[model samples]
Target: MATILKRASKGKAGYGKIQFCGEQARRDGLQYFWVDTCCIDKSNACYVYLPDVSQSSSVLADNSNESWESFRKSEWFRRGWTLQELIAPASVDFFSREEVLLGNKTSLEQDICETTGIPATALRGSALSDFSVAERMSWTECRETTYKEDKAYSLLGIFDVYMPLIYGEGKDRALRRLREEIDKASRGTSLFKREDFSVSFSLSDVSDVEHFVARKIELVKIHKALGVDGSRRVVVLHGLGGIGKTQLTVAYAKRHKDDYSGIFWLNIKDENSLKQSFVKVAKQISREHPLALRLSNVDTNENLDDVVDAVKEWLSLLNNKRWLMIYDNYDSPKLPGKTDPTVVNIREFLPELY
Candidate 1:
């Protein structure tokens, strides 16, 4: 360890990654040298006062049922320094302990997205404005720091901001301040907008909703389902044919129009209508969205199944703004077990909840 520091301190190397970084920097015509090691004083240590009492924080949430002892046992994840190094750069390339070249941030985006539940765009270094507050919190949920204050300090760069680092302020206070900054920066912004594209709302015209009576509970349920940080959700409302189920949904949408980027109302009178509606949505996204072609699961030109799948993939994206789809007047496909085996059901094309 002493020898490694000596070589690095004197702009010399022990013939490994340090040498490679210098060479790469020279190729890029950069005279400055920077390495995570020796760049920051790694030897600076802090002692934490672990309390016997359990503290409840809403920001941290209930990440696990495990005891704090078990949580602290995973030391690598509990380190404050690692997350800062992971996200503070414009682009990051990683290497194994054996010095094997893994990939840059963009190259391993799928793995990152799957691991962190962060959108692909954010991993590729898109602006922090592209993510929601909940999304930001989820990224650091599994991480920890030696100092109570540093758990919050590590996230400043992730959110692309700076704050006065008061080491004694405590992590919860630091995190709360960080959130305040985030809220201030993100203030007055609409949750759903099409800043880059010009696409019209595709749902059919509805009768006036000013007089429509609101069903508050169902509306709240839909909001919660959409806002939940995990899987995609589906809420099914079943009742007699003339029970105002469709009206209830329409009224709910009218009440909460701003909550979604788009609201699609599918009048499922028959299989043909469903297919036509799905295809229309696919074409709309393909024409209007920048990622439409990249996200294609199927070729729209060749087959109907592909187009529907493409639409599903587009909507499935976190980058895709929140959207609400109501399958009003939906009916079951099977007719009392007298089903034709060859006929394709329209319900099959609907996007399955994750």
Candidate 2:
């Protein structure tokens, strides 16, 4: 193993495995091949997972439960380094010791999670910060490292923090240093620090969430559309009136409430109702930020349009991203020759989303 490692490092050795990897890279139309001896940005790299599971005929014949259990119990899964390699990559192709193709990460996610006790969300590439520090730490409890200090050092990618590696620091000191760096990285660094379910939220109702059946496909679409790309995402739930559009939106908000800093709902049934909702939003903001009271001067003497403009400005604050705004009952978008008093131009009420 040490000789193989040495040959892999030099990239010019007579090792058959290294030559095979190079051939695979060429077959895939690539010039570079990276091994997981060290961590890089795995999100950008395709990881070829070579687990040391035997490809014996018995293991292959029946695809039996025992065979799968043996696959899960491979030494590769027990290594501390493989944890990040499994979770960080956007793509992973698994192969057995005999170079037989097994499956990809997405295809074999359930088996991997059963072995590792990692939630499918994290394995599916949800934000690491979406998980708590304790939960992230727990993923390493079962894995082992060669050197005691390496136990802590291997976790740098998991916590998304970095520290200089000192080989002789001992495991305790290394862990203490890792924890200190994690604390420093966490302090005031979040744009939205509100606890789960503690964000300033004004939604339709909680009662609807109880009876709501999961709209799995729609939810997945919403998540994919509004990916973590730091851009404005708008998802319109259009359907016949009274066909549970409101319920769907409510369910989405409640399910993903923690994913945002704030969740605000607007009643766009009509122009008058939209203005009233904006006034309510202004009041909500004023309670948190005293400075917002100046912008939202929502007195009877003040024009409603000014209040709307002020609330929009507050929502448009540069630092306040990850806010979920739902414009409900938008059945009366203004159009040519539409003289209805209830008609509204929703564009006027929307904030400039960054």
Candidate 3:
């Protein structure tokens, strides 16, 4: 672990840049160099040395359209391992045989997309979960590997799954195992699946709500509050007990049901009820989100707090915006003391609005 950390600190600096090139990388504040034949940590700066693309005087020109065409056809992009190599690194610098700096991933985003068929958002570092599984799989369609099983093995990181590598396994069996692991990982996290775009509404209180009329002003206010910007927003609907606070929120959600990715409601009258609401959200989203999958299995009968935290984390993802959560019956807010154990802290259950 210490060795890995030390290498990671200096930056992983090589894409088949070994020997003298590796020495040069070490001098440039990078201690570890990678090659096509070995694997290294993904969280490091990558320096790709394309031996086929010889150094040229016009390579770095701003109008070098032909240079990008040459880059697109480079042997580097056609390898199976290159798919992971391109996407995993936070930073990548391309170079020629004579070590002339060509450009970085940011500057070459358009060319990379054209060659690989990956979306610009993905290449620009959007969460992979935000893309569909089929779309991701298509990125590797043109890549080739030495062994048949290597094609399936190369995609382990893309799907975020792992299993023992069976070298002798045929391509069909390897792909089957890969699919099984993917299925296991995505058991109930369909909320983020690009293929499953149906809006998730788990508010049971509003099931019977219909023919909502009046509160046009209140509904408009709610819409304005949530639509102000791409940031967290909250609007507390304070009113008398029987003056229809709950009904107003229900009506707002139903009226704009198609506007959100998901809609969840929590009964915030007490701590126990709030926790129960979180459990419901967890079950509704998934027993465990991909981020929380390593923590522990979330069962309603056990580890209720894990479920609560996991659900909150799921909502906090950057790509997971457009999700609306309602805290109903928040009448008994807990005071700043142990004397009121029955009361709830509304903030504890609220997710990052954006």
For candidate 1, give the lDDT.
Answer: 0.56
Q: Candidate 2 lDDT, tens digit per residue, 16-53?
A: 55655656667767766756574346645554545467
Clashing pairs in 2: none
Candidate 3 Cα outliers beyond 4 Å, as residue runs: 1-16, 37-42, 190-354
Q: Give lDDT: candidate 1, residue 230.
A: 39
Residue lDDT tens for model 3, 4-122: 44554344454235554565577678766655544324577777878878757565666567656777889989888877778877787888877777778898888888988889888
Candidate 1 Cα deviation (angstroms), residue 200: 29
For candidate 3, what is the lDDT?
0.72
Find the 10 residues in a row with the least total lDDT in model 1. 44-53
Compute the lDDT for candidate 2. Answer: 0.72
lDDT of 1 by residue, 43-96 (tens): 221111122223345312454434233223334334556554545455555443
Pairs of residues clashing in candidate 3: none
